[model samples]
Target: MLKHILISVISNDKPGVVEAIAETVSDNGGNWLESSLSQLAGKFAGVIRVSVSPEQQEQLQSALSQLIEHGIWIKTEHIDADSAPKSDTTNAYIHALGPDRSGIVRELSRALAQHKINMAYLETALTSMPYSGDPLFDATGQLELPEGVDIPQLHDILDEIANNLALDLSLSETPFE
Candidate 1:
């Protein structure tokens, strides 16, 4: 039987970090399943889900511990697929484009909270051209909405806020994959 584990790793940003971590999993006979990795504020952080045979679990844990000794901190937890959150839950995606400002995230998140929506993913970037004095921000947010909520109503609310904020905003239903 394959044991599934969710592992989160945090370490100083450096070359070969991913390779070192992957080597540990490969050496322990774990199958790398899925991962989301990024570098933020000079630190490399990632979350990976892997599957390994029961016999290899201890080896995997030991390998991860060794990484900690080398300055990488890892946290691992066994996951029960049966208890994992279902993605079939309905959701929506909201994308906003406008001048970079301070209140965008706060206002949008407050709206989502009012509707009890869950944020699944959010990415924001500032786009600037050489010699340009101001920068524009593009942000995308994926939110999980209640099953029976009217999507049109949500879109209308977002539209109103976007217009008031002078932002070009769009909302669409994002199918669970």
Candidate 2:
């Protein structure tokens, strides 16, 4: 029988980091399933899901630990069962842009939480405006809305936040399948 393992790895950014990790998993009889990895601030960090036979689990762990000597840190968690996906049928895409500032995410997230909206995907970036060279903050995300929630009211709430924060905010409904 195979068991799923959730693993996180972080190390100084360099070539061959991913190749090394993939080799480690493959050498231990584990199949690399899904992962999200990025290089930020000179460090490579990622979380990956893999499946291996129950007997190979410990061996995989030991092999992964060998990476520590090469400046990579590993953490592993065993998943006993998988949870079903949420069935909220309504989805919305949200976009916001503003001059860089603190607390924008916190405030907007608080409003979404109050409306019981689950954020399905969120991506944020900070870059300088093309002509002005001023720092600009931009964010985009998908939100799942619970049934019977008033979307116009949610818009009003977001509008209030935009006014207060001096940002532009927009929300559009995603077509139902």
Candidate 3:
């Protein structure tokens, strides 16, 4: 039987970080499943899923621990595949941009939570505006909304937040490719 595991890795940003991780997983006979990786503030961070034979679990974990010598910190968790829940929800992509300020995420999340929406993926970045050179914040995410949720109602709530925060926000059924 295959054992599923979720692994998190963090290290100082550098080339070969991903190569090192892939090598470690392959060396232990683990099949890389899915992953989300990013570099932030000079740190390489990622979460990944891998599957291997039940007997190789310990061996895989032990080999992964060796990554410490290379400056990578690894944490592993075993997943009960059987306990994974199934969801029948619709997804929408949300994009928000405005002057860099606090509480943008907080207000957006509050509104989504009130409507029973969940963020499947979210990315936020700070950049400089073209002419003003002022700091701007941009947030993009895929949200999962429960069945029968009112789309128009959600938009109205978000509009209120945008108006209060001086932000521009939009939602779409399709995510930008």
TM-score of each: 0.82, 0.88, 0.95
Question: Which candidate gets the maximum TM-score versus the true structure?
Answer: 3
Ten-residue stretch with the least lDDT total in model 2: 80-89
Give the lDDT of residue 162 in candidate 1. 94
Query: lDDT (CA) for every model shown?
Result: 0.85, 0.89, 0.92
**Candidate 3 — which residues are off by over 4 angstroms?**
82-84
Residue 129, model 1: Cα distance from true site in angstroms: 6.4
Residue-level error in angstroms, candidate 1, position 142: 2.4
Clashing pairs in 3: none
The lDDT leader among the candidates is 3
Error of 1 at 25 (Å): 0.7
Model 2 segments more than 4 A misplaced? 174-177
Model 1: residues >4 Å from true position, as ranges? 129-131, 174-177
Candidates in descending TM-score order: 3, 2, 1
lDDT of 1 by residue, 1-177 (tens): 799989999999999889988999999999899899999889999999999999999899889879987788999999974655775567678788887788988888888888878888888878873577588878888888877777778888888879877789888776322
**lDDT, model 1:** 0.85
lDDT of 2 by residue, 1-177 (tens): 689999999999999899999999999999998898998889999999999998999999899989998888999999853643657558899999988899999999999999888887777889888899999999999988888989889989999999999889999875222
Candidate 3 lDDT over 47-122, as tens digits, reads 9999999988999999999999999999999997564446779989999999989899999998998888998889
